[model samples]
Structures are given as structure tokens and as C-alpha cells.
Target: MLVGVLSDIHANRIALDAVLDDMPDVDAMVCAGDVVGYNPWPAECVDEMRSHDVPTVMGNHDRAVVTETGFGGNGMADAGVRYALDVLDDDRIEWLAGLPESRYCFDGRVRIVHGHPDDPNRYTYPSLFSARLLGEEDVLIMGHTHVQAHERFDEGIVLNPGSVGQPRDGEPTAAYALVDLEAMTVSERRVEYDIESVIEEIEAVGLPEATGARLRKGR
Candidate 1:
């Protein structure tokens, strides 16, 4: 079975749409988290994921939106989270709240989480925790650092699809991953969209201009 793995959507409809359009047919799809937060289209992005019926894990930003636990400070990132919380309707908020912090899929062969296996808010990077986190599962997928990566360990494989909305790996393109369960292989993928359009929308909506500027730089 082919599985499309995505995470850190961060509410950018343009980037999400582009990734969805580029994604190939798969037996299933899963999102690691951060479905909402940052960018300007919180509702639209959540609605899109719901429409597709993708099983998603909760990220720190999604938690902030539902719990009203602000990210702190007056920085653009915090402002984006506040804006996302304010704009997301009750249904979207509930949906974000209902998401699990972690999940096992493919009959427990694949484990999915937003951050680390132990802590959903903690970031997990390649070669850092795979040895400690890997177990009997055939694959473990996570996202949080906004950097695309694929790692293998004696225990299993760890994959990060990167950030679908805000990529901090110096690449503006949306990042994702494809897992071939039957083949036991995983591949990282990137899709380019109209960053300018998203930036314009962010500016038009009065969100921090830094939010849009980050997309241009992929910082």
C-alpha cells in the first residue's frame, strides 16, 4: 500500500492545495500535525483536510488553537497562532482538538506522531532519536522541525515529510513523503506553489508581514 504522509500544514491553503494536487494516488494518507497555525487560511486548510478524511495527529500549534494557550510573545509566529485561533470556527476548533497526539496505522505497523514519540510537542530530527524511539513498527513518521528527512535504524525507519506550509529548510516548496508499505520504502517529495499569492493573502488579511516574508525565504 502507498501512503501519502504530510505534516505542519500551518493553514496555508495555497501550499496545501498544491501538495494535494501533486500527491499521487495512495491507499491512505496521514498528517503528522500542525494542521492549523501560521499563515492566513486556518479554516480553509482545516476544511480541506477534513474533506479528504485524512487521519491527523495533533501538533503544538493545533493544541494552542484549541486550548487558547497562546505561543507567547508578540512575534509574528505568536501573532499567526492567535489569528488562527480567532478565525477558526467551533467545528474546526473541535476537529483540531479531537485529533490524537499519536496513532498507529496499517495494523500497527506504522506509527505516526507530530513530534517525538514520547512528547508530541518535542521536535524529533533524523539520526537524533530514531535509535531510541524505533521499535517493532515497520515505520515511524513524525514532523515538527519543518525539515524533510528520512532515516533508518536497526529498530525501524523514521521519516519526516517536512512542513507543508512553512518550510524552514531553506526551501520554499511544500514538503511531504510517500511511503510504500509493501515495498518498505519511503521517499521525500516537494511541490512548488504560488508563494506570492499566499503572501499577498497574508498581507491583505492584516497578518504580520513577517509571516508572508518567511514563506518567500522558507525560513
Candidate 2:
């Protein structure tokens, strides 16, 4: 089966649309989390994910914004995060509040998570132990650092699709991944979109102006 993977979509409809436009047909989608936070279109992003029937896990920023917690102050240093915190209504926050921290196979083969497999709150990337220690997993996917990576482990492969919004890799484009389950291979992809649109929304909502700048730089 073919699966499309997306992560850290802080809330950029433009990026999401661009990725989807170029994405190949797939049976399902797996999101590495952070569906909201550090972006101006949290509600729209959530709605789009739901519409696509994507399976998702929750990230640190998602937890903070959903619960009105302050843990995201560091992860959400970007202007978009601050804007999402201020403008996301109660209903929107509730949606994020309901997201799960981890998802995987019932038999212990495949797994999906935000951040690291060990600790979703602190770890930014998956560890070798997570794959080898987890025991016989076919594939493991995660995201947090907004940098694309593919690591081969003793047990399985660990991949990060990077950030759909708020990418900090000195590039303004959004990043994602495509996984061919049958082929047992994954590749990272970067897509260019209108960062200015996300910024405009942030500014229009009276969010932090720096939020707009982050989108342009992916940081």
C-alpha cells in the first residue's frame, strides 16, 4: 500500500494544498502530529486532515495549545504559534486536545508518533533503541525538528517527513514524505507554497508579525 506522511503542519493551507496537489494517490495518510500550533490556520488545517481521513498523533505543541498549557512556549516560539494560541477558539482547541500521543501496530510492527518514540514531550527524533528495542517493527515514522531524515535501524526504518509549516532548515518550503509499504522504502520531499498567505492570515488576525516571517524562512 502507498501512504502519504505529513508532519508539523502548524497551519499553512497553502503548503498543504501544494503537497496534496503533487502527492500520488494513496490508500491512507499518516500524520506525525503537531497539526496545530505556530501557524495561523489551525482550524482549516484540522478540517483538511479530517476530510482526508488521515491518522494522526499529537505533538508537544498540539498538547499545549489544546489544553491552554504553557509547555509550548519553547516549541511554539514562532509567531504563528503565538497567533494560533490566541485565535484558536475553544472548539478548535478541543479538537487538538483529543489527539493521541502514539499509534502503532497491535502486533508491534508499525508505529507512528510525534517527536521521539521514547518520550513524545522532550525527544525531537526517533532513537535507534526505539526501532531495535521496540522489537521487529516494519516501519517507524516521526517528526519534530522540521528536518527531513531517513535512518536505517536494526529492526526497521525511522523516517521524519519534516515540517509542513515552521520549517527551520534555512528553507522556506514545506516538507513531507511518501512511504511505499510494499516496497519498504521512504523518501522525503519539499514543496514550495505561498508563505506570504500564512503570514497575511497571522497579521490579519492580529497575531505576532514575526509569525509571518517564520513561514518565509521555515523557522
If scored against the real structure, what TM-score would every candidate get?
A: 0.96, 0.87
Compose the digit string of candidate 2's lDDT tens values, residues 1-219: 778899988777788888888788877788989887766678789889888878788987787676566543464344445667777777777777788888874245568888776778655543333455344568888787887778766667788888887787777888888888777788788888887777787677776677677677666
Off by over 4 Å in 2: 71-91, 105-108, 125-134
lDDT digits (tens) for residues 118-185 of candidate 1: 88878776658556687678899999999999887767788999999999999999999999988788
- Give the TM-score comparing model 2 with the true structure, all chains together: 0.87
Task: In angstroms, give how far residue 80 of model 1 lies from its true place.
Answer: 1.7
Candidate No. with top lDDT: 1
Instruction: Report, for every candidate in turn, its global Cα lDDT versus the true structure.
Output: 0.88, 0.75
> Best candidate per TM-score, number?
1
Give the Cα-based TM-score of candidate 1 against the true structure: 0.96
